[model samples]
Target chain A: MLYRARDLISITSFGEAYHNKPYLDRGDAESTAEPVCSTACDGASKTQARNRYPLRLERLIGRITELSGPAALEASCGLLREVQRRRGVPFVWILAHRLPPFAPDLAANGIDPQSIPFVFAPQPVAAAQAAERCLRSRAFELVLLDLTNQATGTNRGGGDRAAAAQRIDDAALGRLLRLCRQERAALLALTDRHGDLAGSLVFTRFAAARRKGSGRSGARERGGSDSCESGESSADYEYRVTLAKSKTGRPGAVYREVLRGPHGML
Target chain B: MAHTACCNLFEFALQVLLRRVPDWEAHPCVALAHDTPQARVLGCNAAAAELGVQPGMRYAAVLEFAPQVYAAGVSQAELHQHQQRVIAGLYALTDEVLCKPGDPGVLWANAAGFALLQGSPRAWAQQLSMRIERLGFRSRIVLGFTRFGSYLVSAAAQTPAVELLQSVEDERRKVAEVPLHAVVTSRQSRRRLARLGIRTAGALVQLPRSELRSRFGADVELVHRQALGECELPAQHAAVPVQPVASRRPPQPLISSEQILLETQLLLEALVQCLPRGECIAALTLQLSLDDRGQRRERIVPANPTEQVAVLLRLLRLRLERAVIDQPVSALRIEAELCRAAVQQHQLFRETVPERSGKQAVEAFAALRASLGEEAVRYVQLVPHHLPERRVQWRQGAGSQELSPRGSVQAQYADCPGTAQMVRRAFISPQPLARHLLRSGKLIGPYLLSCDWWQSPSRRLYYYYVMSPASDESTSALWVYYDLDRRRWMLQGTV
Candidate 1:
């Protein structure tokens, strides 16, 4: 029973475009027909089948496991990292064109930055690690991309500045999109409300009842003193989330998660 | 080194010097020896006659007849130098100079441009002859408007002309009475003629054209033309192209990377100049020398002749950079020859279009790999997993085409986990079945394979799975199988 009931969660019209398409549902059908399913089950036990909608994480993981190689997983890592950052992170309006400081931090949380893996690496060590592990060992659970700083480090004034700008622009975003489209890894890219993630499924954050100073929720607790700056309150930063892109999941549904986190995030 | 009077006479001189002269280089003359004691003189019978000495005359008889006669040896090097100097002088008159080493110095100069610079063509010949005489060499010079007439006149006259052909009138006069030997009579033909009482150029010229051709073949027709000075010579020039010039200044008197690069650059530049405009290079030759005592190694690189200097430089750089310096090239010289031009035909619509997808894929892979690591990208291929401890896989790159025409590989599992299980629970060889396996109790498996005959053979086996449930380690699946036909047990793989 590869068919899933199209009820349960309220799928926005936009979300239906991502998962309700015939092609999107066909992936599940293909997975069911794999010869490995018979070998894995040993064809001995009878199990009850359940109807599900919009596909589940388990099914997506299976597909990802089947499609992903080192390169694909590396791309997924970039997407997932973006998603994590978009959930909740501090915003410092710094124009410095260099890799952001929290990239390693995000990667440490199991968000791969590359399709493969490498032990002794410099920048994007997490990407290398993911690539090596995924490509060589054929093992990848998920991939996250954090593009909050994708635009940084590209404004170096030099020859053919426009061409350089365009190339960099495409690389920062286009590579991520292509990776997700081709790889089996489930990509989750996150970005702020105003920041453009190029190709990603956007979601909104909820307005919390717990005030910033009161620190009622865990997100508020994380937002410590000195979190507010320049007379503008944390509430002033509107958290707008919308699904920009989704291959196997909902896209338009505005699933709101609060921006407030421990130690301060906007 | 034997001296000679003319390039045309070089062969005659060589044959005479090598056979007749005992120490041709040292003596530079042949010593005349006879039964009677006679003063040795170097001249042949004809020369002896000029000195009032007959062939059979004793040396005393020659002295009595011509007491002032001077006997001198022939210097081959002097003759060679004289020929070269004549050639050089002729080149000063025009740019087209063709001198086949052993051939008579038959030069063709285009007087169309240099007629005024060199004075009248007749004067030029006289001046050329005088110059040769001043060099202590003898020469003859003749000129006409046509090459055939000039050749005939020069052969009939005493020497070659500075300008072989100058005008129509001069050509007509010189060509009217050419000697038969100038046009026909080779050694064998001459001997045959002699047997038939035919002697002298005038006599052969007198023979009827049809009868001469019938009896003597093409030689008769050649003689007839030469006699009438009607044979046409292709218009050519006389110019001694500068001797190919190459020099090397090596650091530490040995080859170095910098030196190699510089030398290649210089050679390429030199070749660019050597090749005519619009002409491309067909081939290039590079010769390297180790040192004063080093051996010379020559390398020939075939390339399209191109007027584009940059292309030549690039090619040279590539060749030099890849050159293996077996011995330090203390000296190097490069020469290039012209080749035919290339003609390109384009399709209707295809232009200079770049391959976008392929380029992007590779660059993206490279960039990601460089920024990330080598393991950043991976390929997926199908392989066999025989046992619990063993797993085999293939590598398929992102750009690799799926369904590689190679049939899908299938791993067959046995029906029952018996002794066959033990055999299956072992390492499966990816390589061909080199050897067979057996067990203590019963026949288990046989490793069978068929593959690339050149590389190795592919293998197919009936594999079985044996599991150890209680081990602290993960359940190790062992692939065991039996060669049903061979009645043999073979352990193929373990996972």
Candidate 2:
């Protein structure tokens, strides 16, 4: 009961800015905050619902953000579209030379593949530099610096750590953070789900991973909700994003988002 | 961390003549690098240019086109003197400036933090132009973000006065329109590009960097990179131009490659010690007296000026490996040009204050495009095709607009009502699909994907490869397919 009271208190403060309002006051969302709160509700398995609001990424604006996990790119793509479409801010995506994210999929996910610009850096250092250049040019309102070793064949522990160090150092992050604050733009650095690679001055760091059963190796969830598609494996997979660290104080808070329909929610 | 401006006193020698005669400005005149008929035209006045007298055209050839064109020659020493004076005038406005050696008349100045001191970046540029104009030479100043971008803008601008390009797209579009001949120094390379029908900077960029360099020359490859705007600029540290000479006379004549490398290392180590208080060695001119077998000379320039001995040593080792050190018993001399200047003098002019444009983020960066070539920065577009791979097409850099066809769907916000989903890790090329089938039993596939869906024997059975030995479904899985034509398995992406 005390835990439930704490959740009520949190819901009051975190949702204070909204007070059951639509994102950016777009006037499309329901006045009742039930739409967004339905999906990622804490301590209530019964709260899982058939519909929910778009994942809220406005919380990370003007921040030096890091997102990692199995579905990190998906979460980031959603954030980019949200900022780009709703807020009307231009953004640039810097990718590794080898890791070419499927553009059709990105377009399906609400991004105007034509509207966003991509910079290909071979290493983390180059990605950081390109991000810096875009920030300085004042053309982009958001910068996505993907330092994940998607191109590198090695996904083991040691290599990721070494690559992270080489790609993202304190000096580079310091400079990027200052620019984000000064320009009031968002900088998102993505990495593999594993490894503690968050650097200093990151205002918010989170991981968007698929929520599994109970343990390291547990069975898939038995029951399903209405929004989930037909068939066992074909249904939209639900992903849980947990805050790893934050300058905003909530370290363990989580949010949930679901995949689009098979034909991209058309 | 502000904008940079390029101050080009076009045709220094011609400008000098016009200033001295005051009447030459109205007449057709050309500044000859040499007075000989065979010598090329270094600079030409508007009147001369109007009469088809072009820079780099032979004076003898110009005689046929414009016989009345006046010719004058300025010595190298005099040109250097004027360049130094103009650089000096520029320093009065900004603290840092850069210019290539032997390539006088054009210089880049740091144009940041002037909104308070002067006004906008445009005003700072105006003051710079006025200061140079006060020196009696007409010039054009373009203020923009990168050193190369700004210089290109100033050189190619149609308007005569100062032009300010503030956005990245504007600078890229303007740079793309510059003709190949204006930037490329070699006439042979320019002709080679012209023969390929690649007239503009944008067209040259479409050609691969390595092929362009191999076929045309190193100069042509450089212009191609610049047009893309992804190229990392070299270090901008030049002041009080100091060339420190350090030499070594081996006690005995050596006959081995090892001895030469050892001797060179010692010389470089010694050179490192004597570099000025706050300057790094920019370039090293290594002259070896090869036992009266003539002198073997090589000038080694680091990507950026550095005081670190290791970085300098690595560059030296690379140069030595390629160099033939067959001859022995010689003296070695190394001349190092100063990379950066002592900041004490600059500090005196202005207070050390934090910049408003944010940390070094606004600082120009030699990014991925610098090493990976112009295609380094690219965007993807989905084309309607049966083959999954063929559906994706790549477009490079910030092209002014999309290359979509007529009646193609415009990508708009209103169309996409749902949030964006995860993107698979797509490989530019497919990798081998191995070890997944043998390990995990939870395979979902045989969707029967095919490049040519109508009727093609080259068919594929696609699958979501669950790498985990456990039966639980993972968030992200590898995307693999078995090809019927190749009779093998290949990994395409992650699902």
Candidate 3:
């Protein structure tokens, strides 16, 4: 949403009352001009009510699992920048292969690509080791694991089609998940599709649709048809995120955002 | 009175030998000639002297005089190098220094005006003695009005002490107290003076000039005149400038990192020996040649200037671990840039926070960067923009500007009233959700936000403060925005 200068709230003028509190009490609502929620719902309605304010349902802190889609990487970077800005938490992105071609998208959103620390480990074992080292060092507040290529492989039966997919290494995934839990730092794991989310034991899985292995193929087909009809590049494809696992919040929460520019999502 | 200072580094040959083998000082040892047909002791320690084993004595004769004496030969080149180091150490005290090449044990400097800057002559003498001792030598300094007078006094004084003569009369009286054997150059001249009842400088000066000249010849007459302060014995001031650089090349190539470190340590010790007093190393450049015809160079600049070899070695070790050495090292060279001693200033009123040593801090930072990548250490900066998301930025390195809690808010907004405070919990991406009923009353806004009309027409958004039905205290409020063009509800942030 494009916000005009006058419409924006001066976070500084808002004072210590709202900082780090996360929620506004009913008393706070009377003192400020911000709108207040009157009726407090119980149990089943709480889930429905949380869906009304989707941002509140998605916990930005602690360990979070992001089901990868067309714009998943871009979204992760955007989230990192936002968290750093509002909370002053620093993050390190661990890439399993070469840096992504769409890294310039970070710069478009006011983040310097050179200033974002990235540990490139092409091998799954190395990537896990790097993540462990970074966590133990306690130098970074957030660890972004890019498992796009690391989690997918060709089918073991030597199929003629190179696109056949296999599950990622379970042992490495287990170790990484354990390290994340032990370190207790906020971890965001980005994958190519929701079907490739079998390895992690700690993630509370979430998918846009409650379908099996075919769910990813269906989404891809839909995205392909939409882009072809509109004559738009694959980069413009839309992404629908599903929380598969969350250590602190509810699972199965779906979020949708449009992939815009080279590296960010709106 | 004009002041002259003479520094006598007693048993200089022994001192130089002891610097290399310190334990030898306890034995009745001497540096002797091993290759000559008739082996001779070149220098002897106090223990050997007690047994009548002196320099120029044959090695056989020395052993016969003192059966337990230890003897070894030291090359003239080695002695000269050590003497040069001692001279370099002295340069830090004064510019005017005199040393006879043939007798490096004795040095004379013009100390006439130094007393005003260095306090009393006795204190200056003691300070100079300490400087010499730092260079691995023991010395005695004597201050007097005449060069010969000061030399005589220093030669007679005990080792590691300073003696100052207040005036020429005092110097004369001190010189007269010295025995004829100590001042005379030859044994024959000393025996002749002793036989003539001239056992001391005072008795020698009491003789008739013609009789003394006739009996003792021109050399004795000159010595008598010098001792009595009648002759002008000019001390040729030989001021050797301090060496600016020192290098060491091992005889064999080093194949192991440990070997290289050992060699580098020896070279550093040699270089430090040449450093002027109160000076330290500021920067160092280490160059290594590999067996594969390739070279590597690394430069290390300590955050705080220091001459401690341990600190420098620690940094070098860290750099070397990261260096990709394709082949064995053929040679290594280290060049140091010297700077004045560092002085750290601390705020008196402020409470002191416990801090890690500079070396430790640098090491920790390097380890962090290696594991997490270069951009891991960063600071936040404010950027000018209308969007709250674009109004702040993170840059590498700890910024000089303090991000005070109040300052952070002030920097974010210009018209901020400095009263209300708010914290933003942002989502990596705004989440789209299905329409759901809210237990809380109506939403806060329809606050219209539109910008960038020239580039794209889909720039309109309607933001609202929606209260979640969840009873959980953490996720109770959310800032949601609706895209007018897309007609979809998106979650922007949590408050």
Candidate 4:
């Protein structure tokens, strides 16, 4: 029954500022037609729904994981723009070992490379240090850690290489999470997919989910079947974002969107 | 009678000569020689004097006497230039200043009716001494009723300043006590006087006038007359016009880093104090002489025009830290150039700009470059390109332009509607993978992407979206791409 209700809310809230509007407007008779036994009961249910699918824009202090591909890049850029719009003067810092060459595509999609500050670290340790220092200063509002190169260890041996790579990734993620919590700065860690899948693992301090399972919570877009109607379309790519950890909203929440552009822009 | 004050700077040639050879001063056995092919020793400091080096000895002969002695030759041109600087500096104290052509170290000024402008003759003499000192010369001042008497008193005074002789009787008493060498021009006559047991002026006066005249000629007679205050010598005022003079002194040789840093700080402070009102130092040039006689020069321009001593010192410290000094520094010279103070607009009520902190950050970065080497500090520069990786470049050192904007992304992309927000994780190199199956979900693939046809043939790629088999959850997705030309499936990145 709860799953059915959650599906209804997710479908109706797409591209709408439903979370921003007041849950119950006293003058609106349409709100009263929802068969409310009591005003307190209706208010409680409304609050519960809001908490289950917190607006992505309002989740300022959280991480966004880009499941690796061109589609992930496009989605991150779009999310960055959204954050910038909502915060007004949000200073975003992109910390990476090396920046990809698709900056022009980002510029074409209205994400200016010149507008974002990039801190390049030659190694993973350096990137971690830079991110920690940048966040501690609170000089930047959003810090994106490009772990794509860092998470993949050099293939020196057969079994040890994979284990070592996983260890590096886990350590980097743990350190970044600690820094984000201490500074209360939003940190997103991006890594490439090892298989034929792409998705985001978001770690946020705002919404702490009570559920324990790893099931998809809300708003899942199926595939990269979306058509490219306008702008420069390079390829059709789809991405899914999962709220892996949150301090204020549902932790296991997920959202999916398809991007179509020369560089995977929506 | 009008009183004349004479100011004599001791070792003027040696001081000015030391500026060119910084390490020579540290050698106890060092002498200045005239710049002739023969190179006759003009003056020897106490160190050389102790080693039997005497004035007028041939440079080669002095080396024979003390092979360890360091001999530096002073050109006539350089000596004359230094002499003119000293005269011009003293000229500022009085208009009626007389500086003899041969005696470049001494200056005679007519203090007659100008006592009120200078407080008193003694005060005027002290002021003149300070002015000469500012020109990097050590000076002694003497005041008397006659030019020769003043000269005698200045030459007799071992200390930097001598008492003023208010009357002719006082001048006569002081002159009688003066050594004969102080009044006599000829070294031969002074040596003759010493041989005859007449070392003091009083003893010279006691000798029979006919005998003195017969022994030393007319010059001895005039010297005796001047010593007795019987002959009055007029001051020969300088004919040349006075020009603005700048003082430059080579700092004492400092071997320790602490001493070097301290001396640099003092120099910076002095430079700041010398700056004109409403002006600050724009650039500084530091010239250092090494022990091996090699020279090292460094020029530093602050990120912001600053008169603050601490800021300048900090930058210098950084520079010194990174500088590789092969030998101990023997001398240092600091020169500062002035510029109009930087003017910044201030918001009336609220803070609109972080100009002060921004400037400090730039200065800090400069210091970092100095301490950590030039490659330590880096800044990002964006290049216009279609390739995502080639579009950004990191360069060492801060550029003049402002740091890239931080919050303008939204306005920049506002025109592009329905743009999917995404972040791409780039791979160092795309990892090759084999075609695999997914347990949690079916594979979603073959999305093709190809570009850059001009440089190379257009390479085709087939991308697929599948769930990781190790993870049971259907939510986890991975992106895989197939390179057609390479004929291989590669894990491009994770979504």
Candidate 5:
């Protein structure tokens, strides 16, 4: 089922923010909890550890494969490359970076990465925005959108604030919400931590016990960080990661889990 | 054997009178015997035969047959016009009509498919006779599988029996007593057969096949079948042509070209509406008679028959522009012969893209040709000669020439003058420009094209060059050439 923040409009932004992140990372977090990640990290060689990434990624790939269905995947070059390293299943990934609005050229950017095995499909504009538009147009199954700060138009030069805000255009987000309501396929929009889309279904990071130390103390000492000064603790962050939204069904509902570990996200 | 002949001579003459007088009802006499060639009474009935007036008797002779008879000559033209009207009226019943609009009116319509619609065959025949009578003409309908059989039955008609033949055997039985004229054969052949005691159709039919073949050619056997009233000719459906719809001409004399064209336009609109739909006439003959005298004028306009009334009118106007009318026309009659439909010949090549509209191009050519005479519209013609002027001759309009390609012939023309005489260029130049300019600014003079003096009295070197305007770089350069001996530049061609 489709999940979008627009569907859960009545859910208080701060109230639902705690559960949204984990909901987005359900698939990744699930696979990382599998036996392969833990055992491969403990006893296996570096080669074995590297190889186990696929085994963990296989589960993630299986989930993506389920979501892909009949309509093929439309993903960016970056997301496709990461998926390829993890799963080993070939897919079309176009380098569609920038495109004019409503131009039919977006259609040309669609590539089947499964064809010409292992060759990443690159183009002048990475087709992430195009892929999101394709999902809105219902041209494909599960589309992967990297809605990082830069893609959200926050990376534009600070001098022209109004122009930069206009460039952000938020129309793409609105279309994504509508697509999540209508499309049978899943829409997995990935955003890094500290992204401004707190109200949107955000994927949160839950480090494994081994490498959890890399940023665990920082989370504990976050009283100084804005997140803590705002009274948002690690538990509060976890709460925001789990809640999901759907148009027809009840909002802030739990759908599935996604696990990520040393190998990669499930 | 010839049947003993019987004709009512006086009755025939009297029937002629009743048709002529406009106010014969107001006349005092019980009957008016109007005649010059012969005489008979105007108002006579079936009982008048008791007074002894037979149809074939003369005016004075009819007095001997019947004492009250008088006489006057027949009005031939009026009688003929009446017959033509009767024939035209037959178009309502059937398209197939045969009319002999002369004396003793005969109209034959083959009703082959009418039997099913009109009940029995005899009923249809009776209905046909009643219909003819309503049209003011008495017709004896004798229908059969063949024309000869039907004609013989019509000749034999007495009081118009509705059912002339009952069965095939009955027809064969009557054939024995039929006269010699009933069979379609030469008189000499009939006599030869009669000498052998084969007097009747049945008698000939009974002869041995081998003996009959040896005595006469195969045609004799075919005739014997026809005489027996057995069908030899295929049943033919009659065709009655529709009466042409007429239009009123203008009040003033058609002196100017435009006035005549306008009158033609009005008439063509009426004519095209009168023609049957989906049928187009190829040639329409327009006959115009002068008012002053009976001096006749005629113009034949050939056109694409399937064109609309507007297109056809324009074509007629074009034709009239070409014709020189000698006298002022009093009456104009337009009669068109339906042109045969054009059948599209299937081409082998599949159409891959849009093509030039040939019909539009042809129409444009026709319009230009109408404004100009044969001399104005010229085509390039090629002759068998080495001389440049003689080798290429220009003809006007359509000409017979084989349009094909042979690469070897082009090479041969370039090699020798003798072989060049046989290699003919296209008779028409689609593009009439003179020359091709080399990349260099200087003009290479026209290629030497001179004829062999002994074969033909023609020699000239033709030069072709492109002339660019000195002042303007954007304007197109004109292709022109000069004849060396003529010492003048001529516009030879352009595309």
Candidate 6:
């Protein structure tokens, strides 16, 4: 069934709208349908689906992935390092009024700054439109948006403080999400620790906050030679990446990582 | 046979430049090859011509003579964009169109079918004129049976806004009467041909064809052939849009949605099999026949154009799943709009260097630039500069460059013993900092960065430290600098 016909039938059993009216599928019906039947399935299988979401991050294609925190750049880059390794995926970084992050730092990380393209959309509406055009092309696999700091436009004291949050309106967001899913392209938006991008449509939502009492500089742990060697690495700060909300994976789970460099993020 | 309508816009580049300012006639104006003063002039208005400014003179030299001259560069790309808009609008007016390749402003539309569909050719030509005028172009529309005939009539400077040719003889007579100074005629060629006692097109056409090329040039010969009706419209280039529509009337009504999907698959497969190589269906329109003989139409546009039946069928299935099927579907018609979906060169197995050859990606960047200005899209370019801001330059991206970096990228901690190196934000322009913010914590460094002493000298004393926040446990890393020349504290950037 395309929609949750059973739930609608059960909820309004007494009403004519339920029995007499023809069934029309809701857009988000499939996502909501799982919880009702979750009790019937084994916990292990449910966990498998939950844990599989992050494990498949490198190979998995689309969805709105939100990562915000002090070390969000590093965390998001760590995930992207694998995707770029696939070689030909086009990547674009979008900026809103503010200058992009330090390029040498981005080069220090595995990411080649020259390889990525940047879009300078000063206003919220323009940024969203630019992003929409990029996504609609169905060519870009990974699009990173800098919705971190408050954009300081021509006006001094403040610009639109909610510029980042209001970047993509609800209607635009809905369209972007659909385009992402259709293209199987990931739209990873990186925000600061105080970002207002904690929306429900986020396929994977998490944050990496720097733990207090920084760890001492220590020898590095290598998953392989794939780690960025150009960056002078030091285990100075430990970040606790907490999953606040995840439509694909289990929420509320915490993972710890020893960040190399303050944030040698992609 | 489709009757051709030729619309000519003379001095298109100059007119496009004039469109920018309303009272352009008040001043001497000229369009250049580029916006720079050194760029050569492309076209000029009457006032500029009166001031001794010619098409090939440098804009700076023109300014030397006429100091109050106004100038702007109408780039070929921009002109082509406007031409595309006109072509697209003409497509809306009529199906078949052949835009003159080099001459972006000149368009030939097949108005044969449209005369009946749109009531009359005069009204349609008026609409066409209004449409081009709205875009700030003065177009002369001439309707005739042949492309060369209509074009010749339209190119004549003294022709009316819209003229309808009654017959082929009338068109030839008008073409013969066209002066040597018609907008389409090359100025130098006109001068040379006039010296040979050929002041009109008829006099030029009377010359022997064997010696036409030897006497004049190949261009004149080509024009002579066109006038003689020897040259026809390039058949291969004539893009007559053919919409593929498939209709299926079932023996019985389909109650199950699955049945409809199964039928849709068959129809899509048939269409895909017939699709030409390198072409994909851009969009699909599904017309569901109701039991009462009414139609419910649903249109679907995929993220990317595809010829694959499965991808299109999946979208249709999704639509059908959500559709309100109040009555059984008795019949169906599927119309597909096709578009070119060719991908550029791809790497089969080589991953040696990062490359972006995706045609769609190129289109993506183009779409961005078309909506936003040229500076809207940018690419990061690393440069060897002492100042942090100068180290990286954000330049406009052409969307066709290689991603491989051959330049040396600076690494602060090239070989540090620490496993983690901190990241810092570099501001394009430093923000002013207060003395109180630095008082809360000990500064890490007085890193001396002074350079360009030979030029407009710049000296800076930089420091790095962590500042404790008043509200939270999260500490903020600050990078402040002291301008030795100004003797003031400024926040360079932050971590």
Taking chain A by itself, what TM-score does each prediction score? Answer: 0.31, 0.66, 0.54, 0.52, 0.31, 0.65
Q: Could you report the DockQ of all the candidates, in the order they appear?
A: 0.02, 0.19, 0.03, 0.09, 0.00, 0.17
In the range A1-266, model 2's lDDT, one tens digit per residue, is: 99999978887787644343322122324313323232322333334432332234556556787887777777776566566554335566787556667767776565667655667776677678778877775556678877776522333346646665665677878888888877777788787754434466777777777633222100112222334223344435556566777775746655555454222211
**Candidate 4 per-residue C-alpha lDDT over B1-495 given as tens digits, one digit per residue, 9 for 90 to 100:** 446777777666676667667677777444355544377776767888888877767877777768887767765546656766666676667767787566667778767666668776666777877777787777777777777777777788877765678788888778789887767778888888888888888788887777778889889997777666677554445644322112233456667666677877767777676665555665677787788899888667676667887877877776786577768787777877654554442223745544223333455445544444454445445676543334556565453234434555555444334444333444434666556433344456566666677776445454444344344332233455666767877665443
| Per-residue alpha-carbon lDDT of candidate 5 for residues B392-443, written as tens digits (9 for 90 to 100) | 4444433111111223433332232111000011112212322333332334
Candidate closer to the true structure by DockQ (higher is better), 1 or 2: 2
lDDT of 2 by residue, B277-387 (tens): 666665677788888677888666554556666756665665565456777756989888664443443354755533322212211222233333446656676789755
| Per-model i-RMS | 23.7, 7.5, 15.1, 8.1, 34.9, 7.5
lDDT of 2 at B231: 82
The reply for model 2, stretches above 4 Å from the true place, is: A1-36, A39-58, A86-88, A150-161, A164-167, A211-233, A261-266, B1-368, B398-416, B419-422, B435-438, B453-457, B469-473
Once fitted onto the true fold, the runs of candidate 3 whose alpha carbons sit more than 4 angstroms away are A1-49, A52-69, A94-104, A107-137, A145-184, A189-237, A246-251, A261-266, B1-252, B256-284, B299-324, B336-365, B368-495
- Residues A172-206 of candidate 4: C-alpha lDDT, one tens digit per residue: 55666666666556765554443211222344422
Docking class of 1: incorrect
lDDT of 1 by residue, B12-95 (tens): 233333343434433222224432336444344334455566433455666676665433333333333344556666666554
- What tens digits encode model 5's per-residue C-alpha lDDT throughout A1-266? 23566645535655444333222222446434432222111233542342222212322321221111100111122233333333222222222222111111111122212121110112212223444434443323334443322221212345445333433234555555555456443444333222223333322211111111122212222222323112222111111122233323332222111111110110
Q: Candidate 3 local accuracy as lDDT?
A: 0.56
Encode model 3's per-residue lDDT on B383-460: one tens digit a residue: 665444444454554321221122232233222111111222333345564456323434555656676577754443
lDDT score at residue A206, model 6, on the 0-100 scale:
70
1 versus 6: better DockQ goes to: 6
Q: Which candidate is the best by lDDT?
A: 6
Candidate 2 Cα deviation (angstroms), residue A61: 4.1
- Ranked by DockQ from best down, the candidates are 2, 6, 4, 3, 1, 5
What does candidate 4 score in Cα RMSD to the true structure?
24.4
Fraction of native Cα contacts kept in each candidate? 0.01, 0.39, 0.00, 0.20, 0.00, 0.43
The 10-residue segment of model 1 chain B with minimum total lDDT is: B416-425
Weakest ten-residue segment in model 6 chain B by summed lDDT: B410-419
Cα lDDT computed for each candidate against the true fold:
0.37, 0.64, 0.56, 0.56, 0.38, 0.66
